[model samples]
Each structure stands twice: as C-alpha cells, then as structure tokens.
Target chain A: MLAIFKREMRAYFTSPVGYMFCAIFYAVSGFLFMLNTVQAGESANYASYFSILLFLFIVIIPLLTMKLVSEERKMKTDQLIMTAPVTLFDIVMGKYLAALTMFGSAFLSSSILYYIPLAIYGKPNAGLYIGCVIGVFLVGSAFISIGIFISSLTENQFISAFGTIGAIIFLLFVSALNSFINNEAIRNFLNGLSITTRYTYFSNGILRYDSLLYFISLSAVFLFFTVRVFERRRWSKS
Target chain B: MIKVEHLTKQYGDRYAVNDISFEVKKGEIVGFLGPNGAGKSTTMNILTGYLSSTSGKAMVDGLDILEHPLAVKKKVGFLPETPPLYLEMTVKEYLNFIYDLKKCTLNRKEHILEVCKVVKIEDTMNRMIKNLSKGYRQRVGIAGAIIGNPEVIIFDEPTNGLDPKQIIDIRNLIRELGKERTIILSTHILSEVKAVCDRILIINEGKIVADELTENIEGALRGNRRLAIRIEGPSSSVLSSIKKIAGVIYADISVEHEDGSATFIVESKNNVDLRKPIFYMLAKNSWPILSLEFTGANLEDIFISVVDEADAEATVGKK
Candidate 1:
C-alpha cells in the first residue's frame, strides 16, 4: 500500500498533472482571497474564502482523482497490481491517500496565505480560522473519495472526471433543494444528506460531532464503495 | 506446481470456459493452444485469481485461488494478453514498482539488476517505457513477471505483438525460465508451442480436446500422413474396406467425379503407409485405382482438426 502511494505521488510530479493542479488551485484561491476579503477589507473573514473555494472543489477534485484507477485500467497496468500479492483494499487506499496528500499540499499553501494576512494585519480568531481550514479539508476529502469511486466505475478518464464533477455538484445541490420538497421529513432527510450542510457546522466555529462524523463516514463510505467496485469486478464483468 | 479441477467460467449463459481441467508439475513448461475466445485467457485469469471460476476450482501450489488468493498470487506470476505496463515510468522505475508491488524480500537494487540482465534490458533501464518500442516494452513486462521469481508463471499470448526475432527471443527466454519454474503459456501459434513447450494442452471451446507430451504431438502429427486416392468402386464398400486396413485410422470418400471415380482421404496411424494395403484391398475388390498421394499432418493440421472436431461435436449435441 505504501509503495502504491509513493509511486502514485511520483506519477503526479513526473507528469504535468501535479503542477497544473497546484497552479490552478493556488491561482484560484489567491484570486478569491484577493477579491472576497482583501479588496472588500473584511478582516478575519476566512470562512467566506473557504466557502468560495468549496465550489471550485468540483473542478479540481477530479484533477486529483480522475486518473486514480481509470488510467491503470486504460493502460492495462491494473493486471500488474491485481496479480500481485496485495489486496484490493490496499491498492484503493494507497491511491486515495496519494490524492489526499496532493489536496493537502494545496490546502497547506493556501493556509500559508491566510497566515501572512494574520501576521501583518488585525488578528483573526484562531479557533474560527482553524475550524474553517478543517472544514475545507473535510469537504475536500469527501469529494476526493467520491472522485476515486467515480474513477473506479469507468476506464475513460474524461468520463470519470465529468462523472465525478456531476456527482459532487448533485450532492452539493441537494441542500439548496430543500424548499422544493413538500414533506418536512423528506426535506430534512435531503438536507442531512447534503455534504455542504455538514461542512457549514465546522466553518461556523462549532465542533459538531455529527458533522465531523458525517465527513469521516462519508469518506469511508465512498472508499468502501470504491473497493467493492474493484472486488466485484474480479468475479463479474464490468 | 499447478492443478485445475473442472474449472468453469460462464458469462451469462455462455461458457467462456466449461469444465476444463489440467495440471502442471513443477519445472514443466506447458503450452495452452487455442484459437481466439477459446477460453485460454479466461482459464489463465482464473488460475491467477484475477477472475473467479463460477463452478470449479483452480489451485496454485496446492492453495485454492479463492480461499488463499494472496498466498497463491504470491507464488505465481502472470503476464496477461496485453503487457500491463505503466508507460509514464522509466524501465528501472517500473521494475522497482513491481518489486515493491510484489513485496519481494530480495535486495531491491540487485534484484532489479538481475531481472534486467535476464531480460536483456539492462541498457534500457533508465529509458522511459513510453519511449521504448513494443518489443522492449514486452521484455519489461516479462521482467516484471519474474521479479519475485515465483514458483509458477503464466503468460497469456506473451509474444502476440512481437516481431519474428523478438518472438524467438521470448521463446528462448521462456525456455530458460522453464528450467526451474512451472510455466503455463497460452498461444494460438502452433509453432511457438512446438518450439518451447515440454507438454501441450489443446483447448477448443472451453474444453481440453487434446493433452499430450510435446514430443508425442510432434511424433503423432508429423509421422501420420493423410492419403488421398481416386478409385473406381462403390463408395461405401471402398471406404469400409480401406478402414479395415491395419494402419488406416480414418477413411472417407470426399468426392465422386463424373467418371464414377471417388476421391478418398485416408488418415494413417503412427506414420504407417496404407497405400500398399489399400491398393491390394481395392485390387481384391476389382476396383481400379487411378491416383494415390500423401500429405503429412503438420501442427496446423492437428490444431485445426482438434478444434474443428470439438465444434462438430458441439453442433451435433445442439441438434
């Protein structure tokens, strides 16, 4: 598993994908920070910055996860890994961790931008700032997990990326769909299923156990589903 | 060692492999001869635990593939129909990845060097795989397969895309590997089997139609010759009389000309010439023989006949 992780990381850097991802991520976050808070003179309001970045997650998460397994299938390299002694769980987790580390790097760099502002200007609430950062990380993790699962479902990376983007968009759209529902219970259920709704709790500086659990469990569910997709494929045709 | 018992795989209602069984003793090189879609890849996939059998068992080194997949996988190496290569990595990097993927306990640097030397890819180690030609890529695939030096190695059409020289090189490499490893190689190329395999398993439509020693196949196919004759006689009587000849294995009147002379194709067993006996038999029956000729049954002939016979039986059963 560690070997897979290390190799996947190397694959990212050797190709243009990792640099492209970092450039797009940092550029967008910098632009957003400049427009939303810096120009608006809204000090200590990093929550809005992450909230805007969360929307950009739909486009960038696929960059991290689109070729996770799909490229292996396309290149037929999955045979080398599958026939090896490692289990499916290890392979999937190794890939997922690698993508997460890529996302983490961008997240850390953006956080450094936040630190610069805090050092030079008015002090931001450390708890709220940290909470928003964690919230954004959790949101990205869940989305990355979904992206990996989507990649496992198809061999074509184009379709995988679009499919992942569509899935994340639909999940995020679910919360805003609350008013259209007539039944209160159904509306509440859809709202609870909304990933963005769970992230809101962390961004508001409230450490809700349910929200943290929701993000972790959501990531787990998708990773489990990815593993199942691979495992089931061994016994049956795609 | 490898053993497969009634191993079957069905896709929906179609049997990709049906009730097929074979075994390979340690250090033996076995060739799986079959045409396309004859379940050669399916059987190899099942044996390697990449695909599960629907209603049978495949055991590698005595461990069942399903029950002990990791253990079994660790003991076997498989090169699928397409070489499973990561084109982005260099040859050395790819081999190192395989080493880690296979969790080889050997010293990584020495092991990669040794495998590269074995496949004769030592000079191309630092070159990216994408830059290498198809032949080099294939050798890299083989290098990956032998990384752990597993007990049993299965290769599915290992030389499918290679040029003539590369094919012979791979055949020689397989032959070299067969000295200590149990190797099961599947190919439709009959000459390849003739060139490398110690034993041969001819599969047709998911069934093992012929399983014999490679030497025996060569002797049986090369020695026995098919004879064609044009004789003036009652077709049934002449065929029956020709079949009764001691060395005649099969006889059939293939065509009757307008002149009333029938063309018969007779197969002799074990290289025995049936021309003299058939001529005497026809003479005793007062039939005039106009032409007699012989054709040796090459490996292509054996492969065709075996697969055709299987198809014929399958069609007959359906009817």
Candidate 2:
C-alpha cells in the first residue's frame, strides 16, 4: 500500500496534470475571493468563504480525481498494480490517498485567502474559520472518493471527469429541489441526502456527529465500491 | 515449481482457456508457443494470479493462486505482453517502486544495480521511461518483474519489439535467469523457443496441442523417414529413380541450381530409413553423391502442422 501510494504521488508531480490542477484551482478560488469580498467591499466572513468554497469543490474535485484509476487502466499499468503482492484494498486506498493529498495541497493553498482578511480587518471567527476548513476537507474527500469510483469504471480520463462532475452537481443541488415538495417526510429525506445540507452544519461551526458520519460513510462506501470493481475485474478476467 | 491442473476460463458463453493443464519444474525454461489470441497470455495471467480460473487450480511453489494470491505473487515475477510501466517515472524510480511493492528485503540500491546490470539497462536508469526506446523500456519492465528475485518468472512476448541483437541479448538473459528460476516464456517466434526453452508447449486455440522437450519436439516431427540429399545428377532422372524405391513415399527435387547439381527432399514410409538404399541406387546409376543429410522438421514446421491439424478437427466438428 505504501509503495503504490508513493508511486502515485510521485506520478502526480512528474506529469503536467498535477500542476495544472493546482494552478487552475488556485486561480479560480483567488478570483472568486477577490470579486466577492474585496471588490464588493463585503466583510470577510465564514459564510461568504464557505459559499465560494463549495463552488470551488464542484469544479476542482473532478480535476484532482480524473486520472486516478482511469489513467492506470489507459496505460495498462493497472496490470502491475493489480498483480503486485498487494490487495485490491491497498491499490484503491493508495490511489485515493494520493488524490486526497493532491486535493489537500490545493485546499491548503487556497486557505491563504482566510489569512488576507485576518491581516486587514478585526479578528474573524476562528471557530468558523476552522469549521470551514474541516468542512471543505470532508467535502473534498467525499468528492475525491466519488471521482475515484467513477474513474474505476472507465479508461478515459474525460469520461471519468465528466461523470464525477455530473454526479457532484446532482448531489450539490439536490437540496434546492425540496421547495417544490409538499410532503414534509419526502422533503426531509431528500434534504438529508443533500451534500449541501450536510455541509451546512460544518459551515456554521456546529460539529454534528450525523453530518460527520454522513461524509465519512459516504467516502467509505464509494471507496468500497471502487475496490469491488477491481476485485470483480480480477475474478472476471480469471 | 508451478503446477496447473484442469484450468479453465470462460468469458460469458465462450471459453478463453478451456480445461488446460501443464507443469514447470524448478529451473526449467518452458516456451509457450502459440499464435495471436491463442490464450497463452491468458493462462500465464491466471498462473500469476492476475486472473482467476473459473475451474481447476494453479499452484505456485505449493500455494494455490486464488487461495493465497499474495504468497503466490510474492514468488512470481510477471511481465505482461505490454510491459506494464508508468511512463512518467524514470527507470530507477519505477524499479525502486516495484522493489517496494514486492517487499524485498535485499539491499535496495545494490539489488537494483544488479538487476540493471543483468538486463543491460544501467545506462538508462535515470532516464524517463517515456523517452527511452522500446527495447530499453522492455528491459526496464523485465527489471521490475525480476527485482525481488522471485522463484518464478513469467514473460509474455518478452522479445516482441526488440531488434535482432536485443532479441538475442534478451534470450541470453532469459537463459541466465532460468539457471535459478523457473521461467515460462510465451512467444510466436519459434527460433526463440529453440534457442532458450528447455521444453516447448505448443498451444493452438486455447488448448495444449504439443508439449515435449525441445529436442524431442524436433525429433517427433522427423518420424525417421525424411531425408535431404545433395547429388550431382539430372534432377528428373534422380527423382524418378528415387521414387521407384519401395520405401520411398515421394521424392521431389526441392532445390535446383544452374550447375545441373540438385538437392532432393525424399519422404519414405513410416519406420523406414532410406539412406542406404538411396546411396546404393545412386552408385548403381553412376551418379556421384555430394552429400546426404537428414532434414527433420523444426519447431516452425511442428507448430504449423499442429495448428493445421487442430483447425482440421474443428472444421470436421463443425461439419
């Protein structure tokens, strides 16, 4: 597992994809930060940053996760990883961790925007700031898992990226559809299923166990599915 | 040592490999000869635990591949047909990654150097794989496969893309590797099988058509009655005279030269050696014998005949 993780992480920096992902992420988030807070003359608050952060994730998550497993299959390097003295869990986890690490790098760099306001205005809500960071991390982790699972289904990077973006978009906007529903039970169930709703608790500095469990379990379930995809392929090829 | 029994792999309604069985004893270099899509790679993949057999078993060094994949994988080094490599990485980095993946306890730096030395890729160790030539990339792939000094090495088309010189170099390396490890090489190149393999297993359409020692495979194709004779005589007369012999099934002037001397390839009945009778006939006819040699069937002929017979049987079955 460690070996695969190390190789995958190195692969990111060696190719242009990793740098392109970070640059695009940083550029878009920086532009959003300047336009929303600086140019509009609004106070830099957790609420404003969280809103833009969610948008950032909707686009950036697919880029980070696009080539995770799909490129391995494309290059036929999956044969090496699959035939190694490692389990399918190890290969999936190693790739997931590598994608998460790349996302973390970009996520951490974007956090520099939080400090710009702290240096200028009165002290912002430290608790809210911390909450937003953790919230975005969890959201990104879950999105990365989804991307990994999608990537496992195909060898084309474009297809994997589009599939991930489509899925994330559906999950992100699922909360908005609740207004049209008259039945309270179905609305509540749909609201619970929404990623936006789950992230709302973290954005507001409320550490709800249900929300955390939801995100953690969401990531775990997708990762488990990814492993099963690989295992099933191994069995079918046999 | 590797033992496979009744191995079968089916895809949907089709059997990619159907009820095949073979064994490779320790220190044996076995050649798997088959045409494209003959299930050679599929069988090697199954034995290396890259794929699972639908039925039957593959045991490597006494461990069942399905039941204990890691244990079996640890003992086997596999170079798939495409030489699975991460092009973004340098040769050294790729090998080091493989060493770690194989969980080798040997001195990492020293072991890597030794492998590069063996595969003759030491000069390209620091170069990115994407920039290296196909032959060099293949060497790196082989290097990674052999990093842990696995007890068994399975190479699928190891010499597919190399030039003649590199092919010979790789063949020699495979022979050297066979001294300490059981090697199974799959290729359509019959000469390679004759050069490097101790035993040859000819597969046609997912079944083992012929399995025998390399020398015996050549001998089995000879069947004791085919001879190549060089004579200083008229082609028509010599052929006509040879065909009159009781044991001669047929005699044809295979090679005709501008000088009137010709070579005749003669086929005799089963269990008959026609050399003495041919010599006596030539002498009685006042013809001078330049040379007489037995030209037995090589691996190429045996492979073609075996595949042809299989195709004939399939045609008969379909009819």
Candidate 3:
C-alpha cells in the first residue's frame, strides 16, 4: 500500500496534473481572499472565503482525481495491481490517501499565506479561522473520494471528471435550494443528503462532531464503493 | 505445480471457457495455442486470480485460487497479453513498486538487480518506461514478472511485438526459466511452441482439442500412417495397384507427369507399413518407383485439422 501511495504521489508531479491543480487552486483562492476580504475592508472574513473555496472545489477536486483510477484502467496497469498479493482495499486506500495528501498540502500552504495579511491589517478570530479551515479540508477529502469512485467507473478521464463535477454540483445546489421546497419532510431529507449542509456547521464557527463524523463516514462509503467496483470487474470481465 | 478442474467462465449466456481441466507439473513449460477469444487469456486470468470462474476451481501448490487468492497470487507471476506498465515511472521505480506490492522478503536491491540482469534490462534502469522501445518495455515487463522469483510464471504472448532477434532471445529466456519454474505461455505461433514448450494444449472455441507432449503432437494427429510416392508408370494402373495393397485404405494421385508418371499419397490402416507390398507390386508391374517417403502431420496441419474437426462437430451438434 505504501508503494502504491508513493508511486501515485510521484505520478501526480511527474505529469502536469499536480502542478495544474496547485496553480488553479492557489490562483483562485488568492483572488477570492483579496476581493471578498481585503478589498471589502473586513478582517477575518474566513467564513465567506471558505464558502467560495467550497464552490471552487467542485471543479478542482475532479482535476486532482480524474486520472487516478481511470488512467490505470486505460493503460491496463490495473492488471499488475489486481494480480499482486495486495487486497483491493489496499489499492483504493493508497490512491485515496495520495490525492488527499496533495489537496491538504496545497490548501494548507496557500491559506497560510492568506492569513499573514489578515494578521497585519486587522484582528482575526483564531478559533473561527481554524474551524473553517478544517471544515474545508474535510469537505475536500470527501470530494476527492467521490472523484476517485467516479474514476473507477470509467476508463476515460474526461468522463470521470465531468461526472464527478456533475455529482458535486448537484450536492452543493440541492442544499442551497432546500428551503424553497414546500413540504417539510422532503426538504429535511434533501438537507440530510446535502454535503454542503454538513459543511455549514464548520463555516459558522461551530464544530459539530456529528458533522465531522459525517464527512469521514462519507469518505469511507465512497472508497468502499470504489473497491467494490474493481471487485465486480473481476467477475464480469469477459 | 498447478491443477484446474472443470473450470468454466460464462460471459452472459455463452461459456468462454467451457469445462476445461488440465495440470502442469513443476519444471515443465506448457504452451497454450489458440486464436483470439479462445479463452486462453480467460484461463490465465483465473489461474492468476485476476478473474473469477463461474464454477470449478484452480489450485496452485495445493492452494485454491478463490479461497486463498493472496497466497496463490503470491506464488504465481503473470504477464498479461499487454505488459501492464506505468509509463511515467522509470524502469527501476516500476519494478521497485512491484517488489513492495508482492511483499518480497528477499534483499530488495540485490533481487531487483538480479532480475534486471536476467532479462537484460540493466542498462535502461534509469530511463523512463515511456521513452524506451517496445522491445525494451517488454523486457521491463519480463523483469517485473521475474522479480519475486515465484515458483510459477504465466506469460500471455510473451513475444508478440518483438523482432526476430528479440523473439529468439525471449524464447531462450523462457527455456532457461523453465528449468526451475513451472511456466505456461500462450501464443498462436506454432514454431514458438515447437522451440520452447515441452507440452502443447490447443484450444478451439473454448474447448481443449488437443493436449499432448510437443514431440507426440504430430504423431497423435496422424492416426494412420501416410506415405508419399512418385512412380514412373501409367497413372491409372499405378494408383490402382497401390490401392490394391491389403493394408492401404486410400491412395490419391496428387500429380501427373506428361510421360505417364504420377505421384500418390497413400494412407494405410493403423500404423502398418505398406512399403514392402507396394515395392513388390510395383516391381511386378514394371512400374519404376522414383521416390517413397513416410510422412506425418506437421504442427500447422495438426492445428488446422483439429480446429476444423471441432467446427464440424459443433455444426453437426447444432443440426
């Protein structure tokens, strides 16, 4: 599993995908920080900053994970992994952790740079900022798992990326539109299904352990699905 | 070292591998001969634990593949039809990944170097796999397969894209590997089987049509003895006299010369020798015998006839 993780991490750098993801992320987040907080003359506006970043994630997370499993299938390298002594769980987890590590490092370093200006210009609430950062990281982790799962379903990278983006968009918008529904029961059910609804607990400077557990559990569900996809292929391949 | 019993893999309604059973002892190299979609790859996939069979079981070293997949996979090294390689990594990096994935307990650095030397890919260790030639990439694949030094190795079309020189080199390498490991190689190239394999298994439409020692393949196909003769005599009378022999079943004239000479291929019942009687009768008839040679089916002939026979049986069964 360590071997797979190391190779996958190196692969992200050897190809242009890693650098492209980092560039897009930092550039967009830096712009959002300057426009929404610095130009507005409001200090410690981490909530709005994180919310916009969550929207940006719908596109960027897919970029990070589009080629993870899809490229392996396309290149037929899955044969080596499947025939090896390792279990399917090991393979899925190794790839998932590598993508998670990449996203976390990029998000952490850029957010740190953004924080320096907030510190100099005005007072920033340390607790709220930290909570929001962790929230966004958890959300990003969940999104990456979803992208990895979608990638396992197809061999084409573009299809995987688009499919993941579609799924994320649906999840993000459903929560925002939940209040417009007339029926209370239907609205509450959609609220429960919405990933952004759980994320709101962190952006509001409220650390809900249930929400944290929710994100972690979501990630496990998707990774498990990815492993099952591979397992089904073994029986169905003609 | 490997045994399969009544293994069947069904793709929807059709059986891709239909009730196939075979065994391979240690230190033996078996060649799987088949055209495309003949379940050669499917059977290899099951043995390597890359796919599951609908029913029946495959065992490697007394461990069933389905029940003990990881253990069975650890014992067998498989090179699929295409060498499963990551193009972004260098040759050394890819093999190192395989080493760790296999969970090898041997000294890593030394084992890798020994495998590279065995496959003759030591020079390209630092070069990325994307930059290497197809032949070199194949060598890297072979290097990966032989990394853990598993007791059983399965190769699917090991020499598909190689040049003539590379093909001969790989054949020699497989022969060398066969000295210690039980090997199964699948290819449609008959000469490759003739050169490297000890036994041959011919598969047709997902069924094993012929399975025997490579040396006996031709003899097994030719159930009756055949003799080809050229005679300098009247074509009609010579053929009739040759057919008149007690043991001869059929004699077909193949070629007729302008000078009343003819060539005939004679089939004798069982393995009996009809040469002495034909010689004596020809001498009595004043027909001079130009040439007489005993002949049996070659590998190509055996392959075609066996597959054709299977097709004929299937059609008759359909009726």
What does DockQ come to for candidate 2?
0.66
Query: Which pairs in model 3 have colliding backbones?
Result: none
Q: What is the clash tally of candidate 3?
A: 0
Deviation in angstroms for B257 in model 3? Answer: 4.8
Q: What TM-score would each prediction reach against the true structure?
A: 0.89, 0.93, 0.93
Interface RMSD of each: 1.4, 1.9, 1.3
The residue-by-residue lDDT of candidate 1 on B234-312, one tens digit each, is: 8888888888889777788789899888999998776676878888889988999999887557789888987888899
DockQ for every prediction shown: 0.62, 0.66, 0.73
Enumerate the chain B TM-scores of all models: 0.81, 0.91, 0.88
lDDT winner between candidates 1 and 3 = 3
Rank ordering of all candidates by lDDT, starting from the highest: 3, 1, 2
Model 3, residue B88: distance off in Å is 1.9
Q: What docking tier does model 1 reach?
A: medium
TM-score for chain B in model 3: 0.88
Better of 1 and 2 by lDDT: 1
Which pairs clash (backbone N, Cα, C closer than 3 Å) in model 2? A238-B52
Model 1 residue runs over 4 Å out of place are A42-44, B218-268, B271-294
lDDT of 1 by residue, A1-238 (tens): 9889999999999999999999999899898887776787755367788888898998899999999999999988888888899999999999999999999988977897766876677777888888989999999999999999999999999999999999989888898888777999999899888988888888899999989988999999999999998888888942
C-alpha positional error of residue B45 in candidate 2 after TM-score superposition, expressed in Å: 1.1
What's the candidate order when arranged by decreasing DockQ?
Answer: 3, 2, 1
